[model samples]
Structures are given as structure tokens and as C-alpha cells.
Target: MGAAWLGRRLDRTIHAISYDSPEDPLGRRVVVRAIERITGQPRLQRIYEAYLAARRDGDNLWQMAAEYLNLTVRYDPAALAAIPRTGPLIVVANHPYGAPDGIALGYITSQVRSDFKVMAHAVLERAEALRPYLIPINFDPTAEALRANIEAKRAALAHLAEGGAIIIYPGGGVSTAPHVFGRATDLPWKRFVGRLITTTHATVVPIFFEGQASWVFHLVSRFSETLRQAMLMREVAARIGAEITAHIGAPIPFSDLTSWTDRQALLDYLRSTVYGLDPAPQRRAA
Candidate 1:
């Protein structure tokens, strides 16, 4: 009965992620289903009751996120200490696991500094759990969406100006299945990170978090991009107890970025820097 109720909303969810993952409670259905697949319906219900009780008792969304992560994620922190607790900063990373990675970033950043935000795809802005940490960018290309994006940019700049830190995924979309000649990879990053560096002169950090969704998640993309994202929604929760490796690179100053005249070269440099933390995810056969 729960699956039946969630089925249509999940279906609608797929269509939405071809563009960006929607911030919908419907998305919660996918994660809940994943948890139920392992813990059974009764236990899942108990977990929800606990969460609702927490809400009633005045627990914040971030605390709820930590509770969820305690059950599912295990990541090592390496060199994360190199990041300064107080400063204007920009951390750029590859969007390998989409939503979960954002949560990981938020959790890690909050550990270092309370005054920080992530520049995220606008759809993620809808998640009440992530609201305090997100500066959402809508990629719809429609005028309204573009306007929303502009506002997001303004906010990001203001945060940077205030000496707060921010995180950004250069790849606008989640990493797609590897191209014919490449391993699973993100689309090219926008020049926005470079622009941000130039504009704010914020310290930039490149982070590489190891791991990806299962092959099952990648296979779902063969049918539709949205479905792939939806499947990832489920897969992410099922990753409980999984080990995640996080490699943090030394920070780079804005003056260093200013010398690079070639946009492609700059992106390649950033991409290679991230891949440097570990071997790049193996590319598919050409």
C-alpha cells in the first residue's frame, strides 16, 4: 500500500531529474523504500515515528540528517584540517553521488565552521533538511528560473563577501554514466567557479570523495536520465555502513587562478586535481 501510494509520485520524480532532482517529499519515498528493503516495514515505521517525535521535541533538520547519516555513512576525514575555520572560501568538487555528497559536504563543513553554505542546484533548495546550508541555482533555462539563478549568485557573492565559506559542484548535473570513451563522469563544469574565484578572491579547495552509486543505478540511466537520478535516490540510503573515502587537497589562492587565461585548461586543472586524490573512477571502454 505504501509503494502504491508512492509509485506515481516516484514516476513523476524521474521526469523531473532529467533536468535536476526535485526537492520533494516524494523523494523521501525512495529513501524510505530503500531502508525498508533492509529493515522491514515495522522498523521503518518506528524510525519515522522517532523522526516525527524528534521534530515535536524541537530537533532541527540538521540533527535529523546526522541521525540518518549515523545509520548509513562512514567516511574518513583526510586533510580536511587544512581548511581554515574563518575566511571567505570556495570548495569545488565533482558531483559523483549527487544528493548524498551534498549532505556529506554540509556535515563536514558544519564541523569546521557554522557560517557556510553550498551552491547547489535549485531543486535541492526545496529540501528542508538542507535549507540552512544551500544557495540554490535553477538550471531550467526559463526566464523565471534564470532570474532565480541570478538571485542565487548574488547571495553567494554576499556570503563570500562576508568571509563565509561555500561549496560548489562544478558539474552542473550529477555525474552521468560514463560516455562511450570514458568512465562514469560529470558533465563539464561551468566557468562559474573560476568566475567566483576571480570575483571574490576566495580561497578554493578541491575535494574528492571516493565512490559512486552501484552499477544498477548507472544502468537505470539507459532508459531515462530522471529514472537514473530517482534510482540513485534509493541507492544512496541503501549505502548504510558503506565506507566512503574523502581526500581534501590543499587550498589554492584566487591570485593563482587569475593567471590562467584558458577556460578549458583551468577546468582540466581542477578536474585533474580532484582525480589526483585517488585514481579517477575507471572510464568505460571506448
Candidate 2:
């Protein structure tokens, strides 16, 4: 990958390393390399290598990601069975552990419906293996990101119109600690998800991933969004061999969603409904 690509994807200043320059003044290369090492980028790179290796061995990205972490997922059987076998379906979930939750939902839903796509961060599209399954949305603030997002929305709408399923985490970003010592909760969700539901008349199924990333992640997130993004892969690596519990809620038909005139209000209700499935006692208060 090019230096610009690395800088964008990894959220580190990789461009500081002047590969073509014979005399590197300002020691910027040293500072950037130190930042990468401190953020565990080398270890994350190794993990990405294993992920690509899995693809070479004929595994899909979701399956490979789950296997790399040895992640075991348990879903509510009754709720899972409630999903309509054929129709436009939207699987909404709380954003807890970033890749783990997305990969888990993708792996589980794929078993039920082969024609499904996930609305995911554009950075994941770099995997190449995941492009078929991902409808990428660039979260970065580049001039091109808005255009890409609009195209992604059009693609998602078309996919649903064709009676395909979609998986989305309404919270545009990961859950974070409300305060220094508070429980983690999702950032305010966007209204576009509700609009999508209304437009497609898709059946809404909620999934609650039962845990958050390491406390250190939440703490780091309180400081810088860029640093938080850089830390995500390392957090995933920390959960190697972890058993992840995901709770599926009863499917809310489009009929039930019609009462709310305001899409943002509807989105809020859906957010609360998903969080309601969290087993943690004080989650509602958060």
C-alpha cells in the first residue's frame, strides 16, 4: 500500500517517513515510527497478515476474522428464528467491540441469508476480501467521503429493494465511557438508519453485543478519536480466544415502525430497544 493509504487506514502519520528522500531532516520518520510501535501497529500488522493468509486458504473475511480471534458467538435461538426467511431485512446492533461485533453479525446472518451486505467503515474495504460483503462508508473527513457515502446509501437502498438483507450499527462510532468512571454507551446515533427502514419497509432485528472493549480503549477514546481508531486492532487482538455473547431481540415489523412520524425519534426508539437486550443491569441507566 502507498504511504497515503497507510496513513488513512491506520490513523497514523505514516507519510512522515520520506521513503524517496536520502536525507530525512526533522527526525519525523523516527517520531512516526515510535507512534506506530507505541500503538501496537506492528502486532496489528501481524494479525492482518494472518487474516490475509486465511483468505489465501479459501476462507471469507468474516469467517477468517472470527477464526483469527477464536471467537465463539451465542445468539438467542428464538429471536434468531424469528427473522423472516425472505424479505428485506435490517439487522441493527449496538456498537461495542468494533470488528468483533461486525464480523460476528456478518458470520451469523450469512448462514441464514446468502445475499446480505453490511454498511461498514470504508477502511475495512482495504481488506479486498470483504468488499463483496461491505457497503463502505468513509468516516474520514475528506472531500471524497461525502460522495462515497451518498453512493453507498444508494447501493444499500438498491440492495434492499432487491429483497436482500442489511446489517448496520446505527451508532456511527464505537461505544465509549460516558465519563471517567461511567459505563460505556453508544454515541448519539444518526437518523439515516431510520429513514432507510421506512423507505425499504425492512424488518428490523436487533442484536446486542454483551461487552465493550478493554477499559483502556474507552479511556483513550476520551482523548482523541484518531488515537482511538489506531487502538481498535490492538483491542481486538487482546480478545483472542474470547467467547462473545450476542443477544438477538424479537423482530420489529415495518408495521410497528409506522407510528413514529419523525425518523430521528424512531431511530432513538430502535436504539433503546437494542440496548434493552443488554444483560447488564444498569445498562438502561447509561
Candidate 3:
């Protein structure tokens, strides 16, 4: 195995040891106190306390999942500020690095907008660490679970109706392509993002992350992608060594969504407008 892989194994072992020990009450207390001192924000401190309480209340699984991943976010403040200040915006981005990406984006959006909430997977919603900011949009694995899926969608729509800022990964869970950067071809099929924007009259902010997680993590990421066909396992891979760098593109106004029937046209418009691409020549239908 490579040195990086070995290092990752060591890190996981350390975390497992620390986490599995049931007699570390004092140690846990000290760590929590240290976090409180470092953050110095009463609200955030309260959230941390709630996380501990939730963990003790049989929510340890989600806490462990969150700790096993890491995130590194980068965005231009000037560019972010230039975007129009519209209430109830839907922030959409390519799915990269699984839950860590959501947590990082959640934290950043929480900092930028007081009413920020994420339309996240139900598994992610189970996380005590992220529950404060995430609003679960459950995705059922069975074709027979369409009703449940519709309920989740309705809840998301209601949240937007309430003037809440939402973060959505339109590609769902399949867009976290491992290895390489700037491979735009890997993006998944566009879905209800445009319709959601059009119906809700919410502005769409397209974001791009320029970097992905470490290669070792990518190995495991691909494994999970194949075995479970879900990207949840990327969180485990990230604990070893995986980082992400984000780029926040400009926002698109809701009024410019006339060609709702044309998927490629809508996608191209989003890419060009948000990522600052020169307009492509209109394609004739083959």
C-alpha cells in the first residue's frame, strides 16, 4: 500500500480507538469544552451541546459518520457578494465529496444567510451534527416508494415557499465522480432544478468545486459507488485524506427560464451564465 493509504489506516484506527472507548467521559467533556471555547458563538455552542445530547440519546451513528469526513471550502467573497440578494434562493451545485460537501456548504450558507437550510438526503438528516441546518428530503430506493418521495418533494417545496434558502444537488447522489478535476462531462442528467426555480420563482445559484478528495479515498469511493450504488461511503474514505475546493458562480434570475422544455438549452444557459461561459451557438434539433 502507498504511504498515504497507510497514513489513512492509522488515522482511522486512532479514531476507532478513541470512539470505541466507553470510559472516556472526562476526555469527551474536555473536548466539548475546548470546542465551546474555540467557537465562542452561543448558538453554535448550543448546537454542539445538542449534538452531544442527541448522541447520548441513541444518535451515535450519524455523529460517527460526520466525524469520519472532512471539508475544505474556498469561495470569493467579492464574487459571492455581487450575486443579487433575493430571498428564497435555491443554491445548486455538482455533487462532489458526498456529505462533507453538504456540511461545508451548509456552514458557509448559514454564515451568509440566516434562513439557510439544505434539502438533503434522509441519511444525512439523521446526522446530529448537521440536523440544525438540514431539512431532510428522503429518497426511497424502491420504485414502490414514489409516494414517500413525493412527500419529501412537497416538504422541500413548502420550505422554499416559506422564503427559506435551500441547497440542492440536482445530480442527486451519483455526481461525485472520483479522480480528475474540471471534467464537466461527468455531470449527471439535469432534473427538477429548473422546474423548481421556474415554479417557485426562486433564483438559481450554480456552484462548482475545482478539487476532489484524495486518491486513496477515491479508490474506496469508487468501490462504494459500485457496491451500494450510493455515495455515502465516500464519507468514510474522506476521513483518511480528502479535501474539496469550491467556486461560487453568479446567480441566474428566474425570469430567464423561458425554454423550460429544452434540457440542453437550459443546462447550457445555467453553465454559461453562472460559470461565465460565452454563449454557445443555438443547436438545431437533430
Better structure of 1 and 2 per TM-score = 2
**TM-scores of the models, in the given order?**
0.75, 0.84, 0.61
Give, for candidate 2, the lowest lDDT window spanning 10 residues.
16-25
Question: What is the lDDT for 103 in model 3?
Answer: 57
RMSD of each: 6.1, 5.4, 11.8
Q: Which candidate model has the greater lDDT, 1 or 3?
A: 1
Scored by lDDT, the top model is 2
Local accuracy of candidate 3 as per-residue lDDT tens digits, 108-210? 5654666666766654543345676666654545663566567766766777788777888776663443353422322453566666676688877777654
Clashes of each: 4, 0, 0
Query: With candidate 2 superimposed using the best TM-score fit, by how many Å does residue 148's alpha carbon deviate from the native?
Result: 1.0
Model 1 C-alpha lDDT per residue in residues 1-286, reported as the tens digit of each score = 7766667656664422122233335555465445434533333334445665567544445546556545343444556777888889988877777666766666666667778887877655444445777888876657888888888889988999999998888887667666322355667888777777777879888877776666766776666644554465455555544555567788888778877777667777888787676644453211
The candidate scoring highest on TM-score is: 2
After the best TM-score superposition of candidate 3, give how far the Cα of residue 209 lies from its true spot, in angstroms.
Answer: 0.7
Model 2 clash pairs are: none
| Superposition TM-score, candidate 1 onto the true structure | 0.75
